[model samples]
Target: MSAAPKHDVFQAVADPTRRQLLSLLAESDELTVSALSAPFAMSRTAVSKHLRVLSEAGLVRERKAGRETRYRLEAEPLQELRRWLDYYERFWTNRLSVLRQLVESDDADEDVLEPRGPRAVD
Candidate 1:
């Protein structure tokens, strides 16, 4: 049988907790559950659940050592997210550039003219 559709990595990363975990993992190679939990006020179980979602999305990996499971960031899935967002980068850049121009331009007449109203319907 064909392989099942992969889970949506971007959607999985939409959570703030997951994003924070990813950031921490990226900075440090591997961190224990307690170490990861120290920065937030959440319970260890809640952090574990966040890690589980990230693991399923292929954004992180957990390795068992003795009684502890260490979590590490896997950057490959993030590259996929970056590639997806690259498509829209130019559109946002263009919009921001226009906004910057409007805000920084020194031409007084340009700002004084109110935008024209739509033509009356027939």
Candidate 2:
């Protein structure tokens, strides 16, 4: 057996393929590796590898039934990502509010706020 992967939710979801798999898993309670592989051109083994990464990151849960293994999304780990994004959302909201105030206020500096494009030398 290979060593367990040390991956965080952010790292696991970095790959587009893994992100797709998460979406697929999220839509349903559980799906086999084959079902997840159907959307992509890669082999089932490739999908399995992605699933393993998600499992390692605690983003997914797996259970075996007969000869097949089913994978499901574990959305709890996503809370961390949500919290991180929430922080930035508030940050940008504050920044945009200040910008709005600047735009509406008469005391604003037009020269500093004006957008400049590249100009040719005279």
Candidate 3:
């Protein structure tokens, strides 16, 4: 039988609902599926599905509590996403700095070239 498709951190967080779930879980030590489902208009099953995606991505861990399953945020997987974003943040910051310098240099040159007073026409 073919294995279930694996999910990555990006794919896991692509859904707004899943992102919300992550945010909620991050604020607490752990919570039951029902507690996680409380804030959303969707049913418990839908919330469970989102949790499943997160679990597959390694962003969440689940523990069996009798008939209830408790889930907690596993933030290590998110480090990968953070690192990727940080690299681009640095890239854009450097580019913006260079652009700012160029603009300021151009302004300085314009100041030097402009006459300080009215032109003395012959």
Give per-model TM-scores. 0.74, 0.88, 0.82
lDDT (10s digit) by residue, model 2, range 1-122? 87755899889989999999999998999999988999999999888999989999999999999999999999999998899999999999999999899899898888868779986789
By lDDT, the candidates rank as 3, 2, 1
Per-residue alpha-carbon lDDT of model 1 for 11-89, expressed as tens digits? 7799998999999998998999999999999999999988888888888889999999999998887888898788789
Model 1, residue pairs in steric clash: none
lDDT of each: 0.86, 0.92, 0.92
> What's the CA error at residue 112 for candidate 1, in Å?
12
Best by TM-score, which number? 2
The residue-by-residue lDDT of candidate 3 on 1-122, one tens digit each, is 95664899999999999999999999999999999999999999989989999999999999998999999999999999999999999999999998688667845677655659888989
Which stretches in model 1 have alpha-carbon errors above 4 Å? 1-6, 95-113, 118-122
Question: Which 10-residue span in candidate 3 carries the lowest summed lDDT?
Answer: 106-115
